[model samples]
Target chain A: MTLIQFLAIGLTILILLKTISDFKKNRINLLAFLFWTGLWSSVIIVAALPQITMPLAKISGLERGIDVVVYFAIVFIFFLLFKIIAKLEKIEYEITQIVRKNALQKQNNRPQKKI
Target chain B: MTKLIVIIPAYNEAKTIGNVIQGVKKYTDNIIVIDDGSKDNTYQTALQSGAKVYRHQINRGLGGALGTGIEAALLNDGDIIVTLDADGQHNPNEIPNLIKPIIKGKADIVIGSRFLKNQSMPFFRRLGNYFFNLMTFIFFGIYTTDSQSGMRAFNKKVAQNLKIYTNKMEVSSEIIKQVRANQFRLKETHIKAIYTPYSLAKGQGFFVGLKTLGKLLILKLTQ
Candidate 1:
């Protein structure tokens, strides 16, 4: 195989292994694992056949496979950014609620001095 | 969460919190004071006044304090929850008038609107109230005479379901949105407010209103 094929194949296999390990460790659920598996499989297919993306790139008005990959990466990063921000906000709300509940419980258990 | 529990969110209102709690006691014995990290003796004074005082480690603003107060009330089996300001701007005597609709099964939420008809309020402040009410109408599709009123009554279910995340003056608007989103009954009553020098001085200014509006708009977009 060519050097580029060897490198791409190595990286795809590494990522696929990591994804399976993450799923086994219960860090990622079945849906996320499937997503990563499908994504890396597509990457592996594209790497094995470098000429396969030409039609996709031309159909999407892009000049080259590299441009198509760059555009898709940018869109994927933005989607991940939105998801992370939303998850962060949810965590913040939960923290505030938990803190409030704990404070109230502590106050109720403690006896107060009556005037 | 069965009896009426009045939840008061106080922040740096040591001067008026004592009297406000005392006035509320005259109406009901189940009084809860959430001291939002006051720098003064607000917690001690509230404790001395015979109201259960929950102290936050740091100031969480009005919404944070109210969130704590409501959580406490719900946990203690509060059948009804009444919220009022600690600056003594709201009259504790009017708690009954506010809760009457809820007790009669006519409404699940009651708002003590100072603008059912303009009371003794400054022109700019009245304008501010109108603007907030209009915004609530546009955003939440729930119109009221005053959406910014601090004195409000909520049923136990409403208290438990209404999730408040804002930590400042924006909470007032957020409450209206929740009321609409949950399809709860909302009623407004004409309640008098004593806008004294102290209250006016400590109350939200025009810029604070703008900031609240911005926060609410962002909250809407995100949701």
Candidate 2:
């Protein structure tokens, strides 16, 4: 095998081990573990061959395989970032509600001031 | 008299919140203040001023605080909910004019319009008002004067149905958006916005206006 192919195999093996470890520790659900394992296995296949992505690139109307990977990588990273931001906003909103509820409870205990 | 409740959303208005609570007290005894995590002494001052006070652990901006205040007012059996700023920009005396139409059953929602009269409102602020007004017309296909008015009065139905998701100054315009969407009978009365250097500084800046528009648009499209 070529040096580049050997390096890809090593990297995919590392990812596979990490995914399996996470699954064993119950840090990730079965579906997530399966997804990561499948993803890394696919990478191992493509990295060893370097020709599988060509068909994908052609189907996606891209000229080069690496270009297709780059485009999809950008899109996936951006989608993940958007989801993180939305989750953060929701958490902040829930925290606001909790704080507001606690404050109201405290205020409710105090007698209404008669002016 | 109607069970009128004054809801004030204050953020870091320690210096002027007491006077606002007192001013509203002159007209009605039921007052609710939502202190949006003020680092200053706004919570104690409003509570001491005889208004029921709720505090947020962190600053939630004008929109978040207003949402909390509205919920509290509805729970407190407020027949008519009148909202005003904690800063002294809104004249509490004009509150009667705002809720008059609601009290008379002429309108379901009454809003205080600063542009209805000739006042010393700054030139850029007026221009900004027109900008958002035109945007509202384009997006919602509804035309109304002073879309960003802070002083407003509405009934329990509105309080029960109106959804507030924003956590910033955009809450003012969101109120108009939701009112139009819900098809509530809206009234515009000529009321003055007391403008001072401090009030102006507390008001939304030019960049904040743009950010509010972006947020409102996102809210419209996504949810």
What are the DockQ scores of the candidates, in order? 0.24, 0.39
Residue B48, model 2: Cα distance from true site in angstroms: 2.5
* Candidate 2, position B146, lDDT: 85
On the 0 to 100 scale, the lDDT of residue B25 in model 2 is 86
Estimate the TM-score of every prediction. 0.73, 0.86
Clashing pairs in 1: B2-B79
Q: Which candidate is the best by TM-score?
A: 2
Give the per-residue lDDT of model 1 (tens digit) for B5-54. Answer: 99999888889999999999888889889988899999888888888888
Alpha carbon lDDT of each predicted model: 0.86, 0.84
For model 1 the TM-score comes to 0.73
- Least well predicted 10-residue stretch by lDDT in candidate 1 chain A: A106-115
Interface root-mean-square deviation (Å) of every model? 3.6, 2.5
Q: Per-residue CA lDDT of candidate 1, range A3-63, in tens?
A: 9888998999999999999999999999999999999998898888878889878888878
